[model samples]
Target: MSAFLSARRLALLATRCPRRTLSTTPRWSADPWPLPHTAQHLSNTQTPSDIPPPTPIPRPGESEETLRARLVYQSRKRGTLESDLLLSTFARDHLGKMDETELKEYDKLLDEPDWDIYYWATEGRSPPERWAKSSVLEKLTIHAKNEGKVVRRMPPL
Candidate 1:
């Protein structure tokens, strides 16, 4: 009977203690994946903010002012602040000089995933072949190299 009680207690302790240990040591400390430096972990330590504001979209046949506003909003609201600042500054600086076709291309580039854009911009990783020759992306490369705060030369894979 003492042995049975001891085994039961051991099983209960095993279940509780492992979870406490694991929770204290985050797995990312060992994993090499490039985890985004976002505000996700802060929610546990700080009060959560409200849902992000909606992105403005240009209406069909909208005025240039409307399109400019839409693009500015999109540029400023990327998944990470690094991408946000890079894109928004580039857009606000150059969009005024772009013709309608150039504006369309720039708008299409904004639809790309933030990780891909961030990697391409800050690390000089070439974008997919489809957009490799895009003038807009070329301009973005220049903008990122000149203005980005977190630029790094990722070691050759």
Candidate 2:
């Protein structure tokens, strides 16, 4: 009976332990994800030059209209609705006063995954390396948290 129990324990241990080393193979190739039809349509609708450049500061002689338009578009269209409202409201409040450097950093933050930004903004996760820069992101994160404070909906109609 003791030998049988020992064998059962060994079998349990074997089942729980990892059998092989994790694979090092990359899941995705170097190519960017294929654009869906909507994304493709949006891209085709605007020329590369017509799109605002992603640098923190606008290029020398770049127009304010271009910067404003880009900021509005980026802030409003985050992949999820929650991020969209949070970012857009923050942008509307602060983008006008942000210096060229702040604008650039905000642009970089926009490049990160929406989920990461949402997590950081809500204080659900620490800011990762990509979010380390940019006072703008810091301020935006605070704003996102504040958005959680406001009453979300009327209790009854």
- Find the candidate with the highest lDDT and give its number: 1
Q: Looking at candidate 2, what is the lDDT of residue 81?
A: 66
Listed in order, each prediction's TM-score against the native is 0.58, 0.53
**Candidate 1 lDDT trough over 10 residues, lowest sum:** 40-49
Give me the displacement of residue 43 in model 1, in angstroms: 25
What lDDT score is found at residue 143 in candidate 1?
Answer: 78
How large is the C-alpha RMSD of every model relative to the true structure? 12.5, 14.6
Candidate 2: residue 99 Cα off by (Å): 0.9
User: Per-residue CA lDDT of candidate 1, range 1-157, in tens?
Assistant: 9999999999999988775434766767644533453334222223223433224355578777777777878888887766787788787678889888788787878877676677667543456765778898888888777854654432111
